[model samples]
Target: VGGAWFAGDCAALSECYSAGSQYSAAPILPDPLVLPTVQHLRESWDDYQDAVEDDPEVGEDGFIFDFAPDELHKANISGATHEIEMVQYVADPVIHGVTGRSGITLVEYLRVSISWGGMPGWSFKPDQAPAALAALRVRPDF
Candidate 1:
């Protein structure tokens, strides 16, 4: 859970300081997970086609996203940062679960999703995507 992608994306604003202790307990993992930055979401997506093509669980038409820290900005409003995951997928054997849905496997996408303008505190909907914020990368990762 500690990598360039995770740390960069997990960067938080002062508002979430109270929750700082939560991320400290991340268990050390053997796989070198990339902590991708906003700069890397697309790169990770681009790099993952082999995963999709190789895995039975993933479809060729996969959906990449503004995952992890990019999505964290939405969580910050509701103090729900705990809900997101801090990792990325690898190509071989196709890591089945890496998203924030309590380990449920969301079908991979070939591109970033248009915003859905979520309920209440979640509003990354295409129209509602927030203005650029240094702490998070809300940009679509196409």
Candidate 2:
């Protein structure tokens, strides 16, 4: 009866927005239970770029790197939903293989970068300190 009311209204609005879709499968309803804070994949990209510059093989421009789709997981956040557990940033470059050749060896290349941020469950309410620190695991989408 509490947050569920808000969740229901949100669901209704979402359905209304999604009216008369030509798609076969129903659009996934956004989960009401899980909430998110200020997060973005762009930051991850930037960090990756920085790491690449540090590598001798990657050169100044980052034209050689490839990005993968972001992945999400549960990532324990015990106290507040907005709280971040831990965020790990990774970027890698992949090298392609060519067809048959003589004795020459042509190898593909890859560059990887990683960074982390945020603490989970840090109660803004001042009381739940221990639980917050204990929840210091990586965030799902990091």
Candidate 3:
């Protein structure tokens, strides 16, 4: 998706038992983390969307701005990426609308709280999203 994409994986190479009789410690491998350092968007300002970007009434700051393309396009028309930017979120639980794909797949977050604000960062802001992000439908490979 657009905005940014980064990821990291921590695989245990070995474990040791703790005083309580539990294998609590694991030695981490080198370069245990992998993630993007820059921010990018999967979707960009295409020619057809230039209008939406230029429309004074509906562009940029509209209360319910739809980033749909002006003409026929796959992402927008097919709901594969009908991105929108409303003046507010109101916790609608949806942002990017798409089919054959989870609308919130790229937006939905996990372990978002005080502790995770610093993973790629400790912040829940969308700008801080890393490759480790996922949707509810996804499963963590333990």
Error of 3 at 77 (Å): 12
Q: Report the C-alpha lDDT of model 1 over 1-142, residue by residue, as the tens digit.
A: 3224222222222123235433233221111122335555557666666677778466534554434332333222222222122244543222233333334222222112212211112232223333432223334454
Candidate 1: C-alpha lDDT: 0.32
Candidate 2 CA-lDDT value: 0.25
Per-residue lDDT of model 2, residues 17-130, tens digit only: 223322124223221222221233345456666776788565444333222211111121111221111222323222221112122111111000100112111212224333
Candidate 3 local lDDT, 17-38, one digit each (tens): 1222122231211111111222
**Highest TM-score model number:** 1
RMSD of candidates 1 onward, in order: 12.7, 20.1, 15.7
Better of 1 and 2 by lDDT: 1
Model 1 stretches astray by more than 4 angstroms: 1-38, 68-142
Candidate 3 regions with alpha-carbon error over 4 angstroms: 1-55, 60-82, 89-93, 100-138
Q: TM-score of each candidate? A: 0.26, 0.19, 0.24
Give the residue spans of candidate 2 off by over 4 A.
Answer: 1-39, 56-142
Error of 2 at 30 (Å): 12
Scored by lDDT, the top model is 1
